[model samples]
Target: MSAPNSLKDVYLDEMKDLWSANDQMTRAVKQLGEKVSDPKLKQMLEHSVGGIEKHTGVLKQLIEAAGGQAEPEHCKGMEGLVTEALKHGIKEASSDGKLQDVAIIAQYQRMSHYGLAGFGSAAAYAKVLGMSDAETKLKQAVSEIYKGDEYASKLAEAVEQAAA
Candidate 1:
């Protein structure tokens, strides 16, 4: 596709990026769940996969509504985040479950923050373009991501105490 020339175009690009990010996160969280030994953290990660799938579907619908193809543009930012997460949260912390849980929480927050920013931006663009329905959906996705991030933060506190 070409460079975004209008607010609608920008919104479509944001949706595509989010779609890719959610796809990557779904896989990353599943793999991280397998590596984590903390029952609570494992369960949270498992639940996150479902949320990511739902958000991805929402993004696809938004893209189609905007007259854009419902396909993902590669999200290099998410790719980098996932790679680093696997290395630090899984491979490097293999011997320590508590530490792995901590790493996973940190990595999860980083990715969630990215999603928050992307969805927030998309919602703003949607508002500017008078696309109220798209804006509402994007805001809903942001709320869900924020809740997950808050949960991860609580888990991080528990993991920290355990590690100490």
Candidate 2:
């Protein structure tokens, strides 16, 4: 659906969508942490989860500041990603610690890329809707996520080569 007619409506809708994405990250990261056998992989997933929580709080505050509600809308998109992550983490994960590390890294990198795209779009929409502050926040988050994706790719590749 399109954004709301008013600024407040736009803020609330964006807030709900962002919150939903963050919540999904929380759940998915937990599952990633649990299923992956490597300690390093688990630590990375845990760290990402913390970041997601921080982003969620920021979105919530922005929504409230804009006179909009700050609750999630049960983001089906992220839900699907999380579900797939769990399934892959379970079935595709290797008994070899290094292989599992590579797999987990791949999963998280993909998710980070998705986050970058999502937040980038949201931030652009927020800017167009005249929520410059929210746009800045989201765009910054997107930049971080893009960096994270690059980092994860390198990490995963290193682990994969080591495992080879």
lDDT, each prediction: 0.90, 0.74
Runs with alpha carbons beyond 4 Å of true place in candidate 2:
1-3, 6-11
Model 2 C-alpha lDDT per residue in residues 72-124, reported as the tens digit of each score: 77777777777767666656777887777676676666666667766777787
Could you tell me which residue pairs clash in candidate 1?
none
Q: Write the per-residue lDDT of candidate 1 for residues 78-116, one digit (tens) a residue.
A: 999999988888888758789878888898888889899
Best by lDDT: 1
Residue 70 of model 2 has an lDDT of 56
Clashes of each: 0, 0
Model 2, residue 155: displacement in angstroms? Answer: 0.8
